[model samples]
Target: MDVDTAPKPAGPLLALRGISKRFTGVRALDRVDLDVHAGELHVLFGENGAGKSTLINVVSGTFPPDEGTFQFGGEDISHLTPQRARAIGISPVFQEFSLVPSLTVEENLFLGREITRGGVLHAREMRKRAAALIDELGFDLDPSQRVDDLSRAHQQMAEIAKALLGRVRLLILDEPTASLTERETGRLFELIARLKSQNIGLIYVSHRMREIRALADRVTVLRDGRHIRTLDAATSTDSELVELMTGRKIDLLFPTITHKPDKVMVDVENLTSADGSVRDVNFHARAGEITGIAGLVGCGKSELIRAIYGIEPIASGTVRIDGRPYEFPAPRRSLKRGMAYFPANRIVEGLALSRPIRENASMTALDLPAFAGFGVLRQAAERIAIKGVMEQLQLRPPNIERPAGMLSGGNRQKVMLGRALTRELSVFLFDEPSVGIDVGAKLEVYEFMKRLVGTGAAVIVVSSELPEVLALSNRLYVMHHGRIAAELSGTEKTEQNVLAGFFREHLLAEVA
Candidate 1:
C-alpha cells in the first residue's frame, strides 16, 4: 500500500485512519477515523465505554493501537511512543491526576522534563517558570505547595499549568472542569481561547452540554467503540448529539416524582463541623421529599452532609432522626439508624474500586440478617441480594465478581446506590450525585432518587449543578460560605433566586 507523503496544504494537524484497539476479549475502539485541524477545539462526546478515553490514550501514545495509520502534518507515523508523542507537542491532562502527591506543584510540573545546567538540576529556574505559568493561568495556588495539600480544584489547575509549560501543539483535556468552580472554569475557557488563537489544536472530553456549546468548534460522537458522527458543534442540537452518543432519545433530563412530605426524617439545627468546613447550618429532610442543597463548589453543601453522616466530627450541633435526638453520631450508629450517605468523591469515600461489585454493594448491609447470621457469613444469600439490586440498577454486564474499578463511571455510581437498596433506610443523603457520569446515567440516578422518595424515605441531595438541584428538589436550600443563605420552594426555586443565594453575602453587602 502506497502512503501519501506530500502534505496537503492547511490540512489536519493530526489524523488517525482505521484506529482499532483491543484489550483481552474487548475491542475498545474499532475502525475509528478522526481528523483534528490546527486551532480547532474538537470535542469528544460520548457516554461511558463510548471509546472517548481509549481514543485519547491512543493519541497520547499511552496505548498503541493494534491496527491504525497515524498521520501528523501529513507524514505517516505508525510507530508512536509516549516520548515521541510529547516531543511532537501532544500533551494530555486526564480526569485522574498524574501528579505525584508528595511533590510540590513546581517539582511535579518539571518532573520528566527537567531543566538542567551541565546535568545539574536547575531548581530555581524551574520554580520561576512554574510560578509564571500558574500566574498566567489565573490559578490561586502556590507553586511550592505539595500536590496532596491542594484541593481537587487546585490540583486540576496545576495539571493545566503543567500542560501549558511545554510547546503544546495539541492539548487533550479529559473532564478538566469536573472539579472546578464557575470562576475557575471561566479562567480555563479564557486560556483555551488563547491557545486557539495561537493555532494549537485541542481535544476536549466532556459530558457537559454547556461546555460543549461554549468551547467546541466541532464534536465527534463515539459509541460502543465505533465512530458514530462528526458534526459542527455550533449547529448541532444537543438532542442530536445525545442521540448519537447513547443511541437513544431522552424526553426528560429530570424525571418528576410525586412529593408527599411527611414528618421530618433527618433534622439538623445549628450544625458545625470540627474542621469548621461547615458552620451553623440548619435544615430538615422530610419523608417522601427530595431536599436539595445547592451552592458553588467549595461551599459547605458537601461538608454539611459529611457532618451529618458522621464522616466528619460535629463540633456543635443537634441532629434529630425520626423525632428522636441522635447524639454522638458515628458511621456504625448512622447505619444502624437507617441512614445512607453516598459521598461526592465516590472513588475515594464511597466505593472500594479494587473490590468486587458484590462486596462493594453488600458492604453497607452486611449486618442485615439476609447477608449474615449469628456472626456467620451467608454467601449464597448475599450474592442473590446483590445480583437482584444490580439488575434493578440495570448494571451492564451485571457480573457480581467483576472489580468495581473495571466498571464505567455510571455503573460505579450504581454500585454505590446499590448499597442503600440492600437494606431498609429512612433517609438517603447524596453528595454531588451525578457529577462525572453521562446523561443516561444521570436519569437513572434521578429515577432511583424518585423511587426512594416514593417509598416514603427522605432524600437530601447536595449538588453544584443548580438545574439538577432546583429541578429535583421539592425544597431547595442554597449555601454560602458554610451557611444556609436561602431556601426556596415551589415557584421560588428559580435559577435567579438560587444564584442569588450563591453570592448572598456579596449582594447584601453591596446593597447595604
Candidate 2:
C-alpha cells in the first residue's frame, strides 16, 4: 500500500497557531505555533518540562488546548477528542503502553476496532490481518502470543503496530525506540521511510542524538514551554541542538571523576537467575569505582543487577557483600545490608506517582530514627531531609508537597535517586539511570554518580547507552546472551572492543 504517487497537499497537513495548554500550576505549552507538512518526518526536541509531550497530547486529542486554533486537512479541528482524532486519521503512540498484558498480540492490536460480520466477531479475519501487518512491518512477533510473554522490545513493536493499524495520516511516536534493540530499531526506521513515502506526516519525540540525525527531516526545538526554533536536521549541529533544548551551553555532559578502586564491595560468583535471563554471570563492584555493565537489549544486563540485589529469583548463585555471603536475598534485606537499586523505569518501579515528593524521597529509610520515632512518623525531620536532597538534585519547582506524577521525567528520576540520600548505602545499582531525561538532567545524574563513588561507595551502572557507560565506568563488563562476554578496562574499554564483545567472537577469542 505505497502512496508514493499520491498528489502533494498545498498547505501543511497539520498546523497550530498560538497553541496554549495549562494545568493546575503549570503552563505546559504556551503560545506555540507549529507546521507539519505531509510526507515530512518532524522531530520534537526539548528537555523535560519544555512542553513537547503536551503539544503531542493536544494534537492527538488527549486534551484540548486552553487557547489556540489547529487545522487538519484545511479544516478547523480545535477542541478535538481522542475518538474524533483517531477517526480523522490522527494516531498517537505514547511512551506509556496501553496494551493489556493478558491479551494476545492481535487482540491488543485491534481491541476497540474489531471487525464483525452479521453481528458475529470476525476472529479469524482479525488474526489474518494482524499476522499480515506484523509480517509487513518485519516485526518478529506472533499474533497468538500473549503480550505478557513478549519482551519489552516486542511490546514496543506491538504498540507501534497498533498505531499503524488504522487510517493514520499523522502518526505521533514518543520515545518509540526507548526499549527497542538495534535490529528492531532499523526495521522501525525502514517503516518510517515507507510511511513518509506514503505521505503520512510523523511527529517523533526522542532525546537520542543519533536517532535525530538518522530520521528527522526537520527538528522543532521547544524550551520553557514555548517554541524556540525549527531547524533542518542536516544543518543543525548536536551542540546547537543541545544548547537550544537545554537553554544552556553544556561544556561537558559527563563529569570526570578519578576512580580510586578500593576493596570489592559486591562479589557475584556463578550467578544465574531462576528464569535464566541472567546465566552464570560473574562480576565485582569495588568501592570508590563506577562499575559499568554494557550490552545489547535483552542481553540480561539489568537482570544481572536485579539478581544480585535479590529483585529476581536466583536459581544458583552467591553474592558476597564486604566479604560476607548474602544468601536468599530480598529487597528489604538488601536495603538493610546497604544496597540500593534504582530501576530502569522510574514511573513503574521506582516511584509512587500519586504520592508527594517528600514521601517518595524518604520511603527508603522510613524505619530509621531520622524518619520515624517508635513507630510514629516524623514529618518535620522528613521534610527537612527531602528538601535538602531535592535542592542537591536541583529538582524543578522545588515543591516537596507536589505529586511525583506532576513533575517532569528528570525530576521524577531525581526523586528515585533522592531515596539513596535518605539512607546510608554502600552499593548503588542504577539501571538505565538517565534513559528518557534531558541532557541537562543526564549531566546531573553523571555528577551524582561521580559524587557517590567519591564517598567510597560501590556504584554499578547498567546502561544501553555505550558512551555514557564508557565515560563513567572505571571497569566495564559486556554481556552477551545472558553471560559475561568480556571484562574491559583501561586500554580494553574502547568502543571497538566493547562492540566486539556484543557478539560471540569476543568470547570465542577469549576461549581460543
**Highest-scoring model, TM-score:** 2
- For model 2, what is the alpha-carbon lDDT of residue 3? 34
lDDT of 1 at 211: 96
- Backbone clash pairs for candidate 2 read none
Put down candidate 1 lDDT per residue, 220-292, tens digits, no spaces.
Answer: 9999899999999989998999888889988789998899999999889999989887888889999999999
* Whole-model alpha-carbon lDDT for candidate 1: 0.88
Worst 10 residues of 2 by lDDT: 1-10
Please give the TM-score that candidate 2 achieves against the real structure: 0.97
lDDT of 1 at 323: 90
Query: What are the runs in model 2 whose C-alpha is more than 4 Å off?
Result: 1-6, 504-512
Error of 1 at 195 (Å): 0.3
Q: What is the TM-score of each candidate against the true structure?
A: 0.95, 0.97
On a 0 to 100 scale, what is the lDDT of residue 133 in model 2? 88
